[model samples]
Target: MRLIFGLLYTLFFLGCLTTALFVVFHLLRYSLDRKVAVFGTVFFLSVFVILLFTNALIFFTLPLESLFPTFNTL
Candidate 1:
């Protein structure tokens, strides 16, 4: 069902965000060079955001009903 797929996608999206946060936190907390830490965080976050947004865009555009037309039928 569309609703189930939507829920799963939401969970996946949240998981990605949470994973990014942990990565950023570790980069900032464990790195020896402050400049490298900051740069790495910025670059990673930028790419991650762009990719995540693109993923969401593509996901929203998928024809779920057409893909799962028989899901609701007996």
Candidate 2:
């Protein structure tokens, strides 16, 4: 069904995006602080959740009609 596909896509994309953000944050935090890194960890997790939620909301509302126009015609 359309609803299931939409949900699955949204969840998959959100997970990837969140993981990417977390990895980048981890790298940056390590560079900035070699010791006492819990603050960075907490910040990374909080931001990840917020951004993931926001991205999911946007993806869920996106119109399916807007996809594929940029593909090269073969």
Candidate 3:
């Protein structure tokens, strides 16, 4: 039970961190580009929206029972 919850918590935090780092990488790269591609902005925004929604869903929909069988109250 503890191990399952631990793994889920780890994955949730790591996913959020990874998405944040990806956005930061894109921002830094775009800043460095002298002739930033026009479509890059659109693409970046699309990806950001997608990732944000995905993370939100993951965080909200995670099955507590799978992680903590004892706390299946919910």
Give the winner by lDDT.
1
Encode model 3's per-residue lDDT on 1-74: one tens digit a residue: 44556688678767876876677667657666644643565577678769877876775676766766767553
- Each prediction's RMSD to truth: 1.2, 6.5, 5.3
Clashes of each: 0, 0, 0
Evaluated against the true structure, the overall lDDT of model 1 is 0.95
Off by over 4 Å in 3: 32-74
**CA lDDT of each prediction against the hidden true structure:** 0.95, 0.68, 0.68
* Candidate 1 wrong stretches, greater than 4 Å: 72-74
What's the TM-score of every candidate structure? 0.91, 0.47, 0.43
Q: Judging by TM-score against the true structure, name the best candidate.
A: 1
lDDT of 2 by residue, 1-74 (tens): 44655789867987787787777676666665654466566677688779878987887686655564443232
Count backbone clashes in candidate 3. Answer: 0
Per residue, candidate 1 scores C-alpha lDDT tens digits across 13-73 of 9999999999999999999999999999999999999999999999999997788789867
Candidate 2 regions with alpha-carbon error over 4 angstroms: 1-11, 14-35, 66-74
Error of 1 at 24 (Å): 0.2
| Clash pairs detected, candidate 3 | none
